[model samples]
Target chain A: MPLALYTVILTQIHSSNKVVQIFGTINMSVYSSQRIALIGLGTIGISMAALHLSRESNIVDVFDTRPDFEQYIHKTLPIYMSELPSPNTDPRSSPESQPSTSLVASLVSSGRLRIHSTLESACASATIVQEQGPENVDWKQTTWTRIEAVAPSSAHFWTSTSGIAASIQQAKMQDKSRLLVVHPFNPPNIMPLLEIVPAPETSAERVEFAREYFSLPGSRHRPVVIRKEIPGFVGNRLAFALLREACYLVQEDVVDAKDLDTILMASLGPRWAGNGVFESYQYGGGEGGISSFLNKLGGTMQTIWDGQGRINVEGDERTEWKEKVIAQVNEAYGTVSAEQIQIKEARLKDIIGIQMKDYNRHGPEV
Target chain B: MPLALYTVILTQIHSSNKVVQIFGTINMSVYSSQRIALIGLGTIGISMAALHLSRESNIVDVFDTRPDFEQYIHKTLPIYMSELPSPNTDPRSSPESQPSTSLVASLVSSGRLRIHSTLESACASATIVQEQGPENVDWKQTTWTRIEAVAPSSAHFWTSTSGIAASIQQAKMQDKSRLLVVHPFNPPNIMPLLEIVPAPETSAERVEFAREYFSLPGSRHRPVVIRKEIPGFVGNRLAFALLREACYLVQEDVVDAKDLDTILMASLGPRWAGNGVFESYQYGGGEGGISSFLNKLGGTMQTIWDGQGRINVEGDERTEWKEKVIAQVNEAYGTVSAEQIQIKEARLKDIIGIQMKDYNRHGPEV
Candidate 1:
């Protein structure tokens, strides 16, 4: 069964302005009504649907192979379709199972989202085909191949894969330049930053269109170009770098985990809300600013920036730390049951949702 | 003429709860109205007075060698008394030019903030003495000797010194236990975190009192203790460590300064509001958490923990960098005159002030 374009939701349709439209390379214009077909209903895929559906009325169609997906969809989304793999299908025992791609079809039948069988049916008259397949290169290549074979040449192909270059995967398709990457933050529904990395083969017109489409009202989206394909792109590379040092600091016992948190929360974190790291340093060194800061403290910092301390990843050293952390948490605010924690998490999610609403309403002031 | 506390201010008596009394060691209580004498009005002294008067009703009698402080105080604070150093105050001249060591009679001048000529007059009858003297040990020793002789034993001594140990300075005072370091962050009027480091010889009771004094209501203060003195304390050490890497990264051209800032702003800065580096990793790695993060990425991090790149503080390197950084700023944000930049900066300051007021009024929920 082919997914219908009427299933599309105008997530951010500005009636006065009409729906936000993006002109794709193949003369396809993506509006609010364009049906979006998603393959692989994993963590990333599920989060994308949650974000998309939370907006105006963007209908998301999903497919997966899991038999118990109906239960999961009930937990993850309000409305979804459900389909089970045929009883005759056995990924291990039957060659038919390989062709069926049961996982792909299961994504739709989960009752929380829509799903379709063939790529032609999934992307029939669709404006966009978002491939949320596995991170592995060969797997993505195969997925793109299938998408290209089934979908019309006019459909814009987007991948939610991180760190993988669009060109590498695009080469598997006939119209390679039509593909681009929209790597979003983990739990994309909650975080708004989306790294839009386009292939060298991708055109400026197509890239601009994707940027505009992602920036629809009510969507907390920020896009930065990869410029060139680099491992980890921009955000992750910097994040991983910071995380790496944080780990070494903990492992070395330079400061306890709790106090280290206090150091940041009480000092740097609040300042960071208004200014980023470089800008904070810009103000921190006073009139002399960043230059003075570098001159006065650079030597001291070099001394402290010793080789990475050995990490205590194994349970032995960390077990004590783990218990201590749990104990400290319990001490500060009594130990919460799993259910209570979940309830609190949900409330936090609500607060975050409200914040996004306020942000959308106000927009970025500067 | 010892500076008189009761002589200053409108003295609008409010309810007991509105008084904001901070209980000190033993049965002594320090009210927000306690006259705080600020000695040595240098950069640190000026900043401290601004912060103290920003919210508190502390009568600040400030003394400085420079006579032209009235213009600055008039602009920043509604309350303050300024005193000029004796005329012909030159070391090269006769010793008679310098004010006598008995500072009480010479310095104190009756005003909203009683200007004091000597340390004795400045500390006389004051509940707290905030010393912003030179960082030189000899200068501090001489100043403390005079302060101890004149200040009542009941008064608590607080030093706004950096890097120097509280214990080392306390050894010169009669009331050693009452002396503690209240090292505030740069631009103390803006940044709220205060390092509440006590000397080894200082009593625990004094530590508790100091903490309470800074954390009073209407006071946007965060007090952190260092059980033992470490050069630069916790915040600076941690801050400098991060800064060194940023500089090194810029020098190596791994990333531009602007891009580095953008990466931090988009990727990890927001997350930092809720969780610091350690807590962020603890949560970032998922259930396995910090341990898992270390296990997976620790090796990769170790590979990149290289030494700081070349930095030239004087002459060619600095001059070149200054021009380059300024040009980069202009290129990024467009050409603007210094006056225009200053206007932009002032606007940012106003925004920060409003945000801070809102945060203090409503607490961190905003």
Candidate 2:
């Protein structure tokens, strides 16, 4: 039988949990491969693609308007799309700055990639298409609609958006049931949480499939149902509530920003990373515990609880804080740039992750 | 000068700095040879006295109305009061059944200890006194009045009460300046933070002295000022806010108690232990930092903010929650032993303290 015929037969058997072939090259009858496509080759997009390629899978295909296809494709994968490399700094094409093509070219030379010319050609046989384009709703809807017209009907479409509801994007897809949201935290490869929120019409089978596909052995993935689309979603909504108060305290001058962080650092924050909020109160509060504590003082807290503030994406207060922080930074350690701080923070995060892993394996006593 | 005259001159200089002089075989500073008078040897009182005697360069004088203190007191710091330890375990002294005393004795055998009798005799030129007695306001007032009559005016007084104003205790002291509320967050010696709140009339000089005294190099002593005497104090006030919601959620069946703890453990809690509610928000709310985040979401949070159900302390809600918690404990952990849990918690607290010290030095990144 032809390899294509054998592959088709194997895919059908695998879907039903049965083995159809047991030859050398096709040792596992269920080892069927699916073509995966990329929507935009921006920073987030490229990173997502790189991570997938880095998995060393024979299943990935790269598609971008950028003619620089060979730059990012893993030699084990293939890239196909309309010609002309995306302008390195185009906000609509790449969300983050494009890395030098040398990095992408190195992956391609590893000997397992193909570059293609058109969007239709890239999506013809693809089973999964991840859209990591500009965040603008209109732009996303338009781009997704065009991709939907070309991609295979069976392909699952996933959006990597932080705030937008998956259903809204899914509505633009021809096969809405296959559309879902896979909101990975920044630097997804490092942060273990991937929030899998499905739209109202999304199927359970697809959601389950997505969960299995995204979660590795050590990843901490959370499947929180939106039930209904809300402004910030669950994590952000709760997180923002805490953030609002933190910001209000700084703005009100109740506590210094660093001191506030220190207070959390000393007591609450690290604990939260280990135990959730309620358990913490259980351990921290005396006598009747958390419930009793609330009865005693919740009224006062309610009266004092300030609502969320407006988003100043421009970060006016942050700039002021930065100026003050710079002075302290200079006094403490001469001077340091934001880039240096980010680098230091990144390194610190890596150390923390290693420590956490060790802690889990050895128990906290060690 | 004559020997008596020289003694008076030497004592004056020592007392002026608030440090007592131990002129036995060796002339050691009061701190190095600490004389701690623990008044009212109730559960909390005896534990603290035993802790001080067992752990450091300290002497303990435990005073209580009970009539049989010999069995509990270490021979080194034998109890001697007009009234001895109560034969029947009073609710106030119920904690005596625990291993805390043995733990104290073990720590004491390592070489740091002493004990005494009589308020006046116990406090004779002593550096510190820990008052752990009845919680009644009038009872405390009368007890404190007696304490003022005998305690050295310069000695610092640390009262151990779950929830009471330091000012009230100070009002009965001869020298209000030396009175402070050293309220511990359960299992005092183990928990690193000792809420050091001073009374309204507490002098700045005395506050400074007390801060330094508690600072004790390796110890993590947090000095917080209560601008006004509010119920539950600062930590509890904040803790209550979270607990109220926990109860609300449980009561409303929005989530189970265990599930709630799990959610917090997985995300918010760990960060909170290190950063605190305010700092977590500052970092989590985006680059606009805290203030901007607050300005953006405070209004919305306020809208959704349901403080707590209006349950009177005597209401059925409290009893219901208690029952539910008890039933859940039996179901989940097999047996429900509050005493055992407390001991486990105390052990955990010590571990938290050690980890916290390491955390402060290296920060959450570690």
Candidate 3:
């Protein structure tokens, strides 16, 4: 296919779930039942496994050093799956039959969701790898090299590293083009954003493949192939920008931490949820659109940016800014426990579910 | 009522919509029935009128210099109303009667929704005034002074000014305490936030009154009282911080403006929609809570902030940064139009409706 046609196909696939064939390439069915290897069992890894295994067409292989990896997933998979939107809930999309038993039970019993005794065993038949290992530089480099030794030479490698760039992670690998960063927003399964950061050596074709593959069935992930590596990628960088200003406001006693959260939840939060910052401002521009908004508000925006509280502390030791903020956070939210995380995750899931449903009914941009 | 009791009652009112009467003060039923006068008939003013007029008990009075103000509201209101969640849709909230005719027709045909021939006539009987006048300091000062000359001396004031602090606007007024900024996020009727900004002279009692008043029947508003009058206030300040960084990234060719928006819409937008930045960070902290998150990621956050794009340019004329960003914006979204905005607003209303419904079913905090 022409490169232009290939790009168009990828964009077009955003709305449909039919089996996509590239003639000379692989066949990607609705579920794309590929042999997938999950190398780690962190929260992200577990979430990814649950999502992949639940898709009836996937054959997920896993290996974790933990003695109780099977029991761990057995207990956690159900909890994660419970929060996901019911499959085929979108009336606009095609529907498929669900298995009679619990998804985890059915997958496990049928051996579609397999646990290998060794890393080599897990990678032996795998065509794809999702490595959510420890966030250490040396650890990732060594792990990828070992996986390469056993896994298929053609097996594509992905990492969930939030901070590390893919170039560093793929340095030791022989097939550099196959390895890259597909960092997610915390839980890999739920958040729709996947920052696809390919190393300098990674191929363009592989980037498209990663984008299409991550966006396959049973995934809410919308892959954005990052043009070039930047620190913190896109989402975190944007998040930290807001976070820095929030920290400054609280430090200055402009508003309490709780009120800061309340203000965002009431206004900017929901506004952005439905519309992007740029588009929201474009709407604010009235009939003139974005250029008009930029021309009119660019000065005010610049003024606010100049006045933002400086909270760029370099060390790990608590800056007075961080100290005041953490104190406020505790005072406002109290000592958050595991149950607190559970409650928030549930709410986040429901929030995303509502978004996805609307996304299905009116399309994603709507 | 004692001051302590008065404050407690305001907080309590958040959960219940029953008649909240302070023995010595005025009675506030579920639908306060407050006689509200709206000055100016711009988009904000028209939307505010629609919201206020829809409530069964409100006696809405509106006036604007534009000769077509009456005809404009007649045509614009129904569109805004269409975007709001259906009145009393929350099953958890008490049921209310609906007028048989279209809300605008029913209210206008009756004396309940009055469009006065002059500003003096509109404010003549109004107990609470919602001013959505043009964005000018002198215009506001003169308008408020004029309204105060005729309106009830006891009338409380609210302005929809995004800039020009209330203190500056109220400097010329006799009762500065009554005229604080109850700034709404764009279209006041549909968006759920009302930023209550008080001048130093503004009394505490008026703050609570504005809070309860804006949040009455047929309103989706959740008021957050600004502790101090910072420039751009909280929501806009946070928004600009993110925008500045986005502009920088796009300018630097790290990402296109469209992809930047895609990253946000897919991740942070919806994440923050369901969760506040602080609360979300606290969740990211896991069992360790906000303190852990701060300790672990604070350094990285600081680094990102230190490197954020600085686009804070003063003066209204075009800046290179602004030019690049505008070119990119036009390139990405094409020419934005009135029709485009309508689509977005409809989507925004649905997003907020979904949010509000969830909020009702499981308390706001849930």
Q: What are the root-mean-square deviations of the candidates from the true structure over C-alphas?
A: 13.3, 11.5, 5.0
Candidate 2 segments exceeding 4 Å error:
A1-127, A131-135, A185-190, A220-229, A247-255, A281-366, B1-33, B39-112, B115-125, B131-143, B160-162, B168-175, B186-191, B220-232, B243-260, B273-366
Say which candidate scores most in DockQ: 3
Per residue, candidate 3 scores C-alpha lDDT tens digits across B276-334 of 88888777786777888877886677778777876555664324566777776767777
Per-residue lDDT over B157-247 for candidate 2, one digit per residue giving the tens place of the 0 to 100 score: 7787656677886666667766767665543433444556667777655555555555554444454443344455444444444544454
Tens digits of per-residue lDDT for model 3, A186-290: 655567888998888988776777787777655677789888888899899999989889988888888888888878877787777767777777667866777
Q: What lDDT tens digits, residue by residue, belong to model 1 across residues B1-366?
A: 111222122133244333423322223333446667788776568766655554435566776656665544444342221111123332223423533333322222423366655667768877778888777778776777777787777667788887677878876777778788988765455455788878778877667667767776656666766666656666766665555455445554455667656555554555554456665555545666655655665544433433223344344543244445534433444433344333333332332333332212223422
Candidate 1 structure quality by residue, lDDT tens digits, A1-366: 111222132333444566444322223333444557777667677766655555434556666666776556555553211111123332223323223334324434543246554545666655678877776889888888887887777667888887468988876777887888888775454455677778888876566667767765545555655555555655665555454444444444454556656666556655544455666665555566665655766545444444323233343543234445434333433433444333323322332332222221224423
lDDT of 2 by residue, A1-366 (tens): 444565577568778987544554542121334456877766566556645554444456666776665544533122212111222222223324543445445544653344567667767777778877766778777777888888877677788876567777765666777777776643343344455677778876666556655543332334333334444444444454444344444544444445544444444444445445555445444555554545654445443432222222233443243344323323333333345334333432332342233222224422
lDDT of 1 at B350: 32
* Poorly placed runs, candidate 3 (over 4 Å): A1-33, A54-57, A81-85, A88-111, A316-318, A336-343, A357-366, B1-33, B78-84, B87-109, B313-319, B337-342, B358-365
TM-score of chain B of each: 0.68, 0.70, 0.86
C-alpha local distance difference test of each model:
0.56, 0.51, 0.75
Q: Candidate 3 has which clashing residue pairs, if any? A: A302-B312
- lDDT top scorer: 3
Tell me the TM-score of model 2.
0.64
Order the candidates by TM-score, highest first — what do you get?
Answer: 3, 1, 2
Query: Interface RMSD, all models, one decimal each?
Result: 5.8, 6.4, 2.3
Q: Lowest-lDDT window of 10 residues in candidate 2 chain B?
A: B76-85
Docking quality of model 1: it rates as: incorrect
